[model samples]
Target chain A: MSLTLVLVQTLNGLQLGVLLFLIAAGLTLVFGVMDFINLAHGVQYMVGAYFAAWFTAMTGSFFVGLALALPSALLLGLLLEILVFRHLYGRDHLAQVLATFGVILFLNEAVRILWGAAPLSVPVPEILSGSIVLMPGLLYPVYRIAIIVAGLLIAVLLYFLVSHTRAGMLVRAGATHPRMVSALGVDIRRLFTLVFGFGAMLAGFAGIMIAPILSVEPGMGDQILILAFVVIVIGGIGSIRGAFVAALLIGLVDTLGRSFSGDLLRLVMSPAEASQTGRAIAPMLIYVLMAAVLFFRPAGLFPAAR
Target chain B: MSDLVSSASTSDVPATPRLRGTVALLVPAAIFLAFALAPLLVHAGLDPFYLSIVVRIMIFAIAAVSLDLILGFGGLVSFGHAAFLGIGAYAVGILASHGAGDAFLQLPVALFASAVFAFLTGWISLRTKGVHFIMITLAFAQMAYFMMTSLSAYGGDDGMTLWTRSTVAGSKVLGDTTAFYYACLGALILSYAICRCLVVSRFGRVLRGAKENAVRMEAIGFDPFRFRLVAYVVSGMICGLAGFLLANHTEYVSPAYMAWQRSGELLIMVILGGLGTLHGAIIGATAFLFLEEWLAGFTEHWRIVFGPLLVLVAIFMERGILGAVTRRRR
Candidate 1:
């Protein structure tokens, strides 16, 4: 609607976009490098939030909680890879999907048992608790701004690491040709483990960052995981740049669609009908965008060379 | 037992003459026979509640068999199959709410809607192979789910209840629980036969050949995509039939009928029973639902036990329960 509302919603969209990027970056990489589908990847995000919540409560500092959660998340990822995912790499996609789905079930239920079904909330740190005025009348939460900034910084860091570094080159090589990379004497198994762990940590980091804003719940990651899948699919599987671009595109489209669809519909229809149709259409905008994208380019926006 | 062994091993080892005549007919006949006798057993002093459960199993078995057509035989791995189920149910619900409660009318509408959906989405989805196909199907299913949720005129997120069961040729025979059970059983039998015929026909062979090697199938003067698309549409129609039965069985329709989780469960059922075998899907539907029911009897947190068990099945029961049974016989 108005300029102020648009500005605030834009910020909200950016925040969601960054969170998606964090999760999708890891997802795309794992998918690209290993050709494995990890449905339980979302659980890592959930675990990260729970770890942040529990650790923050114990340590009495958000920063301390994050520091603890990151490594723990990484460890959990490694444990799962060693126990479950390692066997699935040699199997078919159906097997991988079913196995990981089992992991999701176990983890979601485990989280419920550990921390009852009630949603756990994390308080925003005192320093970033209040809203800061952007323009004359626009004010936004400082913590959200912090999340956006942090996400952007990580994206920049990821871009540099993926494009410039030696390990990054190996990753890129693995994505395009894993068998070739393995044949070249690189330890592809270890590389997969490393990538898988790092991706889990990144997803966990997203969870930890968003903990203060969103309710940390058992299945919270499931919905976001679907959104992240949409991001990767639209962006192109296995492309970080694609994930980043698509994540932002989806985030903005989804947020702005929800915010403005009613008003836009009212231009043609009665207010009541507009609101009802808008409510239905808003949640579907991203999927429509995804379908449209796939219809034109089945491989996605940035198909990683394979 | 001879018929069961013959049917179970017939398609699996078609290369050998000894196995060719057996035609895995026994298991399915046995399965249907057991289904037919289940209600009698309930009358003979078993829990009457179980008859309803078997009816539910048969309803899902139809959905699972439909999924197996594409997933196992066609190798399409459609992750949105539940959407067709929901479409079928919603068609029934919407029609009945508007005072049209005839099975003859609802069945055609459900099948037609599902076929249209499958054709359009399959046209797009079949373009991409592997994981892209899976994700796209899921996204489309989610779109359908959201669309259903947005239909505030028809209950929206909370779902809607059907006031009465659909009438068959203006007869309210389906109103009785036993009659409903028999109706569902008849529907499942019809669906199974349709799928069985399709999987064994020239069309089914093309689908199987394409699944094994699409390039080879293409080189042999067959268009794999067209075959796959047709198979996808047929599969959707059958799943929609299951949805129709489901609406009648529960007399309720909700957006939850097509959730991605339900789609996942359908995949599990197909895999659990053994993919590519129509009767295996029936066995899987029975096993999965029974397992859930048996586990739930212990505690509400049944998934905690069921989850790891699924992982074990994926790891150890690679061929599924039917495969396991057949292999042991060999």
Candidate 2:
């Protein structure tokens, strides 16, 4: 209800939005280019968290761990592409969903096997730890602000890569009309591999970034993966700009709804009833938002040309 | 059963039955008869544990058979069918908690709750095709799950335990394992028969035609939406009945009943037995449950092995167990 609290929540929402954008970007691209739904995309995010945790523990340096984690995540993505996803490209969406689901089961268990089921935490870097006052009586975590900044930079970079690069054009084409791209003599398979790999790395990067704050545990990606899917669906399946905008919107809505639903409901109902009803509705707000969005724009906002 | 139902629903199939068609039908009938005898096995000094397991399998089999109604027969791959089961289970839990322990009362409420949910969600979800439909159904199910988690009074995340199973005409027969097993078997057979009848009906043909080619079906004067919505509701009702039995069978109900993972499991069962073949849902559910039971006996990390097995099935075993059985008959 207070301005400072709202401001903090907004910033938190933005940070969460950034993470979702990173994950959604990869998923949308893989979906757009190859018409494949990689349910295991979330597992790649989980893998990045585990790999970063392992490397940080081994090297005793957070930055070094990140430095090593990126390429390894990319390799992991491409390797999965070759091993499981490649064969699924021409198959139906059901097949893709099932296979990727298998990948999730395998990876989640593999992580549990390698690292016990107990939640693991990576400490925030000393330099990024603590809070800064954004206004009178309003202090926010410096690490979260850094996450927002980093996420925005990636957004700008992604915008540039998609709009200005030849590879980006191909990706766009793949989403809109893969057959046309095929007719134009480009190796569509290799292009899909590139896009899929890049998407995997982006998800990995998000996982590594968030490991400090959220519990890095098995199956953590499952919920976020669904959220990312919601983001892409609201933004329009193949549209990066849609993903960015929708991710932020979803982030803000979900966070603010959770924090303010009780207060908002109290205006019309008794305190106890309001609070209980608000609590129930908070978790469902995003899904409600998605349903409303789809009602108006069945294909999502900023639908691809295809 | 969806595989067979789909054939029954679609008109393009040649009138001539395949040489193995009788064998395929017989295989599932044999399986059902064998399942019905599970309680007998227990009474004859075989482990009663197996009866409980088979009852659980039948309960899931009911849910899976309903799913095949839409997924296999109608070509609507709903990823949230478990929500219906959850709704049905919750219906029993809520009513029983309030003192309505009668099967007649619980079954109607469960079916009504699930049917209404299916009506609302299906109305919205059926508007989209393919991947969007899957995601939308999944989203709705998750919404239901979150709602369940927020229900602080009804045991919330911990779930609720029934003091007694549902009564049939004021009789306590359901409290016995053999009685419960027969109840479940009866429900499964009735559902299978209803689904088969629906598939062969004219309305079902329209749903099938739409699945095959909506535009063509539309040209033929069918409004695909109405047929699909009806199919979705019918499917939800049957699954809801399963939920009723499940609540009694386990004497427990939780939000976990509607988890997306359970939905995934249901889909895998339908696929494993061969999609579109109604009876395959039973086979798939049985195989999947048995595999889980057998594998867990070997190691705590059975999921690691099970995961790869799912992957192998997805990648290579396209026709599933029923398909393999009928193929061999040739």
Candidate 3:
């Protein structure tokens, strides 16, 4: 890759990483605090994209549509909490996994039923529709750049909240020592509900933000959900810092690997053979990285010192 | 649940004092005997379609039963068990593509590939516990899934059609549905018996011990990892053999065989049959496949009902199909 192409790919990777962070953050917090394995969390992201698509068209203004989506997504998250997820807290991992697997089947099908099985698109807002040139000839999409900025801002805000705020302390404390937190007269159940709801909102927020750039369709979340799980696992299940770092690393490796694997392979092999092998290996890049990391550090890089 | 675990061990023996003459032994024998006569039923004008369907179920039963050997008895919840199935199928597919169509060659390659895959992946996955174990297993399976989809030579995402089924000592026994059914059935029985014997052996005890309390097992001088790894390999090999049979039954192979959803279905079958019970896997696969077939006939959107049905079962039924039957008998 040329210097400009490399720079653009790095930015693209960052954009993807930021989206992953938004999804993984909520996932890690819930996992850390509640010890619940939610296979259906990806559906919440799907819901967000679908909700954003519908609301945007209904309202006919991108800002108004986004404004309406956040609250609706929050309410939907809460509704799922009350109806299904609340009862699952004390169950074993198998039970939790199977039940949530069922939820995935239901929700994916339900979305297809409600929205028809076609992909929906949200047009970029006029303000962010054009590309900005970074140098003499290098150009980047303004909306993608906005996503990176928004994601970074959220990361900073999340760091501040998790490190400084009272509620954040409770979440962190609960993650590391739930029994002690409860013994200290904290209403652990209430705190858990708040965390779960907030996590849902974050996943939803990720969905809405990416809706304009990607297809808003059923099963979109399943693949990303798996990626989020990989990030969470590599980052250490309950660690936010781990999630951020791992998410960025995975995003960069995946993007850069997909873009450059064939060229790298061509240095040693025939072009035909090189491109095929490269294409074959590109999708497996993150998983290979994960296996390597896990081999050296089985508990993950930031396992929250429990 | 604790009682179920202990009871599972007792039932492993041929004639336990407390479990002598229990229906568990009787019911399983009757079921197998019926399966042995399934071809006869086809001769009696039973739908040929039903024969193929049941063959598919039995193939999956082999997979699920092997999964139970580890997931239930060995206390290893591998979320990527389908990867073994894929590896096994690919071994056969790849070999056959290269002009090798003999079972002796294809099946063993399938077994070796699957065992190696399991050993390598299990070595890493077993290093972690709980949800990490689950996700790591899943990641490895996703890797297998992605790799298979990118194998452009073998038809890639579209998969490859087998020109011919594997032959047994120069005879095309696998091409005949009745013969193939018996072959799958016989393999299931053999694997089930092997797993049952393993469950009753000393090694099985260590594996089960690790499942119940790894620290306690460690304190008693058993690392539990070695035993779990063996169980994992054995399970993968058995599932691999199932994949071989599955490839023959369908006369095709696809990347879908290794999809994460397929792995989930294997786990579900093991649980639906009641975890840790050998016979439960067979019964669970039958129930699952039957429900899936019946539900799909009702509508294209059958998953809507099927999904909720699975949820209800997970919530309300603690013991699964066999668990309830055995419980009521007691």
Candidate 4:
């Protein structure tokens, strides 16, 4: 690939990575703080996208629509926590898995019933919708750059909240020792609710932000959820910093592997054979990375407070 | 309470193993009779569609039971169990497409592929426990799903359809619906039997002990990790056999067969039936399938109700269906 193409792909990878971080940040935090395996976290992301898309279509303004959608998504998260997730705490992991998976089934079908089965889209606002020239000969979508910027901004905000705030201290405390935090009389249950809700909102935000470009459809969150899981596993569960770093690494590896694996293989093999083998092997690259990471560091690259 | 005392005394008086043995046979005997008789009572003379559905349920029951072995008894909670299923199905599908349509050859290839995949993935996954282990297994399975989807040579995401079922030593035994149903039933029964034996065996004791207290097991000089790994491999192989039956039943294999959702469904089956019990898987699979079928019939949005139902079950049922029953009987 040419230098311009390489640079563009690299940027694209970074953009994807940041989006993953947005999803994984909430997931890792929830896993860390609540010790709950919320499979429906992906459904929250899907809900955000669908809600944003529908609201934007109605309001005819992306920003206003997103502003409204965020609160609704958070409300939904809290409602779900109160109605269902509250009961799952202290249960075995298997129970949590089954219960959350049921949530996934319900939400995915609910979205399908509400929005119809076809894919929906949200429009990129005119101001940042156009392409921007990054180099002499290359142009990148302004929307993608916006995503990268927004994702990083959230990451910085998260770092601050998690490292500087009292709530963050409680969150970190809960991650390492829930019983001790409760013994300290910090209302651990409420802390867990807040963490779960916030994580849900973050996931929803990621979904809404990316809605303009991606297909907003039923089960949209499933694949990304798997990728986020990989990021956390590679980065170390319960570690936001690990999730961020690992998300970027996986994003780059997955995106670049898809784009260049075939061409890279062609250098040493016949074009047809390279294409076939590359296609077969490309999907496995991240998993191989995960396995390698686990092999070297069983806890993950940067395991959180735990 | 008096009856319990009398039964306990009687059981304590030298014939306890025999009594326990008879009780163990009771449920499966009842289930066997029902399944055998249900086909006879069908309105449309054993509607092929229902037969197919039941067969599918049986096939999945095998896989679910295997997963329960690792998750419930061994405390492994693998999320990539579907990968073994996919491996087995793909092996059958690929081999059949290449003219090796004989069940004898296809079975070995499927088993071997599944065992290898399980061995490699389990070797790494068993290192982690709880959620990390779950996610790692899930990631590995997703990798398998994506790889299968990318295989444009084999119909890719749409999946590959076998023109015909595998042959049995130059005979077309699998082509017969009744025969195939019985064959799958046989497979399911055999798997259940093997699991039953395994759970009470020496190996099963160690596996169960690890689940109860890994630290204690380690303290007692058992390397719980290795035992868990072996269980994982065996569980994976068992799921692979289920995959083989599934592919044979449907005559089609798709990436969807190994989706993480399917893995979740398998977990639901195990829990719904009862954790740490062999027959629970069979009941769970049947009940789950029938519930879905009935619910979907009532409303297209059945999962809305089903989802809440699952949450309620988790909230209220600490020991699951079978556990609740066994406790009451005790």
The predicted structure with the larger DockQ, 1 or 4, is 1
User: How does residue A22 of candidate 2 score in lDDT?
Assistant: 96
Candidate 3 lDDT over residue span B1-330, tens digit each: 234433653344321112234444655677799888888887798889999998999999999989999987876788899998888888888999999999999999999998998899988888877776787788899899999999899989999999999999889988888888888889989998888888878887788788878899999999988889899999999999999988888889999999888999999888787887778889899999999999999998888998888787777766677767666655
Go through the candidates in order and give each one's DockQ. Answer: 0.72, 0.69, 0.65, 0.66
lDDT of 4 by residue, A25-113 (tens): 99988887777888999999999999899899999999999999999889989998998889888877878887888888889989999
* lDDT (0 to 1) per candidate: 0.89, 0.87, 0.87, 0.84
User: i-RMS, every candidate?
Assistant: 1.1, 1.1, 1.3, 1.5
| Top DockQ hit | 1
How do the residues A1-306 of candidate 3 rate in per-residue lDDT, one tens digit apiece? 698988899999999999999999999998889999888889999999988999999988777888988888889878877777787787767877777888889989999999989999999988989999988889999999989998899999999999999999999999999999999999998898898889989999999999999999989998899889889889987899999999998899999999999999999999999999999999998988787777788778888988
Off by over 4 Å in 1: B1-23
Which residue window of length 10 is worst by lDDT in model 3 chain A? A290-299
Q: Candidate 1: which pairs clash?
A: B3-B26, B4-B26, B6-B22, B6-B24, B7-B23, B7-B24, B7-B25, B8-B24
Per-residue lDDT of candidate 1, residues B191-244 (tens digit): 888888887788988888888889999999999999999999999999999999
| Candidate 4 segments exceeding 4 Å error | B1-19, B43-46, B218-221, B327-330
Give the worst 10-residue stretch by lDDT in candidate 3 chain B.
B12-21
- TM-score, candidate number 3: 0.95
- Under the 3 Å rule for N, CA and C atoms, how many clashes does model 2 have? 9
For model 3, what is the error of residue A105's alpha carbon versus the real structure, in angstroms, after optimal superposition? Answer: 0.2
In Å, residue B289's CA in model 2 sits off its true spot by 1.3
Candidate order (DockQ): 1, 2, 4, 3
